[model samples]
Target: EKVAVVKEEVRSAAYKANVVKAERDALRLSLSVQETTQKKQVEQLQTLIEVAKAGNQDYSISNEESIKQTLNVSEQLNEQAHAEMQEMRAKIARLEANASSEIQNLEQKVKVVEAVLVGEVPAKRMRRRVKTKMKAAGV
Candidate 1:
């Protein structure tokens, strides 16, 4: 009878030890899963930070390029406008010169007509022709 009782007690102790060992293994596995998940999350956050920094740099570079292009276009427009203004001034000066020459020609014609009418030059034949035409026209 004592031998049989000893065998039963040893079996019970072994079973309880086995249960404790299983619980410890399950806790160790849970901790390992949590640690790995946290590591992955940290790495992902780090990658996002780097990407945001790169994007910010790209934005600044693009802005600089945009400003440069705008200035270049503005300068080109200004140069074209200046050239057009100079061309217009030249055209106006030519027109004024032509008008002055036309006025001088008209003034000379007026002077010749006055000299012909006033009988002050050596034009006796022109005076006799005008008198004959006036008499024929009944003026």
Candidate 2:
């Protein structure tokens, strides 16, 4: 009976671990996809910029200022896109770290629960006390 219980607990731990790993992998894959898309967009922008520069040599006197203004707008857009990409990457890093921490805590709780069920001294209580604390604070 004891061996059966241990085996079940180990299986549960393995399942939870796999879930955590899968979640992390999914997030990483999403970041990779976003990065690839951003890279293509940047490359396209550079090609367009080069094309405009090439066309500038044939510009008329009256159209020169208009062309310059258009170039300025394109430059601004490129800068904004770059800035937004940086911001998004930063957010992804933070979210990945938070998810990793949560997964670790969950694994620890599972270990504690397994230990307690096997009549061992639990290293830490597995109960989620946060809900009680939140209710007390009227959250």
Candidate 3:
């Protein structure tokens, strides 16, 4: 009977470990997906800028200022995207580190299996962070 109990405990620990690993994997996967999407968007912005530059050359001088402003806006967008991507990468690194340490701490706890048995999976990963844009002073 003792042998059976020990075996069950071992299995529970293994299951918890697997779940923790899966959670970490899911987190990392999400960051990679976001990075890929952001990279593609940056590429698109570059193409748009190039197209705008070529278009500006063909426009009359009277429209030159407008095209130049458009080009400037496109450049600003590219810079902003790159900055956001870098910030996101930093966030992923921090989150990954925290998750690894959390998993280690959780491994030392004995009741993880009960949580598992009752289907109490952690839902923190599903939360989305929202950033509201602030309006400029003039528009």
> Which candidate's lDDT is highest?
2
Candidate 2: regions farther than 4 A off: 1-59, 122-139
TM-score (all chains, Cα) for each model = 0.46, 0.48, 0.42
**Model 3 poorest 10 in a row by lDDT:** 130-139
Question: What would the per-residue lDDT of candidate 3 be over residues 1-139, giving only the tens digit for each residue?
Answer: 4334434655665665566667657766776676577667656656765676687667465455665676567667667766776676676666556656554444433233333334455553421110011011110
lDDT per model vs. reference: 0.54, 0.57, 0.53
Task: Give me the displacement of residue 50 in model 2, in angstroms.
Answer: 9.7
Query: Which sections of candidate 1 miss by over 4 Å?
Result: 1-59, 123-139
Better structure of 2 and 3 per lDDT: 2
State the lDDT of candidate 2 residue by residue for 71-136, as single tens digits: 566666666666766676676666656666655544454454445456564233423453343344
TM-score winner between 1 and 3, please give it.
1
RMSD of each: 52.7, 8.3, 18.0
Question: What does candidate 1 score on TM?
Answer: 0.46
Per-residue lDDT tens digits of candidate 1, residues 1-139?
Answer: 4334434544554554555556556655665565566556555555555565576755565655555565566566556655665665565556556555544444444444445456655677877765565445333
